[model samples]
Target: MLKVLNAGNETLYNNVSFNIKGQEIYANSLILICAAPYFEEIFVESSTNFNQTYNDIEPDSFRVFLRWLYGESLSQAMQNYEKEENRDIFFQICKDLLLASSKFNISTIKELIEYKLVTYIHDDLVYDNLEKVIELANEYELDDLFKYCEGLKDVIKDEADEPENSNIRVTKNNSRPSIINNLKLRFFKFRFFLKTRTEPGHKFKVIN
Candidate 1:
């Protein structure tokens, strides 16, 4: 009852349609209608790393495969679903699809991954995913991916140092004047004077 489209050999289920132009599996309205539930299950299961698994597929072929997998267009596939469950499921699918595309050495997929990383820079969960993305980009020799990851290192480092309750301020007491205390005071005064005299707007003013 379910019609299966095969990219390899350009064939359809029951061998009803055959062509040499290329194997593009087009799901009919009836097939999409009947296959929604099954497709949903497959999408969920394969949503994690499906793209990496099919990395050997050529770009054109993979695009065709994607078209067959999602009855909608690429733009539609990128839309955020309303339902929480659907949104989560779709993102998982997109992640898997990107991984698969990377595996296939697809430049477009690499760019997409970079875009996603830049877009989600503020996400706490992005670091782990970005690590993997960096590894993939390195392995594939994707220059843009490498640059994006390199830039992300600074962002991640800043985040790591930004703790709410970790500030430490030391106070000095003038009650006891030791050599160290005198030196510290002199250094503080020198720094303050330097800051005051180094203003760009008053560069021509002489410091007394």
Candidate 2:
């Protein structure tokens, strides 16, 4: 329907066109009216303006929703395009879709973003953005990702505080003592090592 509608199929009079964030798109009222009650009211009150552009959501993210309405799956494609480049932008748009979905009470879109966020816990989800993502999870009541993020605090801590090296050295002196006696005397010493490297502008304390 989207492909046909986008191709300017004037025969489909049952559908309505929209300029969402300056990008033109449209969908069948029968399909979107039920999913979004706001559309239903717009049609009911005959208040929809075909020329007016709706700026409620971002253009690209709104395109995602329009595609989803046309029977295309969103979450699977997002997971398949997993890349490190522009991670923040992708997640930020996810947040936008989440907000837009929430506004219309579209649980499917909301759930799609939740699943993506849960997957992010294993990827670039780090301490820098942890608080923001956790806030979003809490806002949406995404218990799964919330608990996952909580568990990662410990995991990230372990990653940061891990010992760089731990070695044990052993020495034997036959004149001083037999091998067995030397073993009993505790000649082996354990050493703990840690890396001193830290990123610039990161908080570091020095002792005099």
User: Which candidate should be chosen as best, given lDDT against the real structure?
Assistant: 2
Instruction: Report the C-alpha lDDT of model 2 over 53-159, residue by residue, as the tens digit.
Output: 66777766766666665555665325434566657667767887787777766665665565566555444435656677789989988775576667655544644
Q: What is the TM-score of each candidate against the true structure?
A: 0.37, 0.64
For residues 1-208, could you state the per-residue lDDT of candidate 1 as single tens digits?
Answer: 2224434324343222222134433333334223234333343555542222323333443443344233433333354532334544434444555655554333344444344333332232245655765775576666754665666555445544657313312123223234225334444454354345333221111112
RMSD of every candidate to native, in Å, equals 20.6, 18.1
Best by TM-score: 2
Runs of candidate 2 exceeding 4 Å displacement: 8-15, 47-53, 76-81, 165-208
lDDT at 21, model 1 = 36
RMSD of 1: 20.6
Give the TM-score comparing model 1 with the true structure, all chains together: 0.37
Q: Which ten residues in a row have the lowest lDDT in candidate 2?
A: 187-196
Q: Model 2's lDDT to the true fold?
A: 0.55
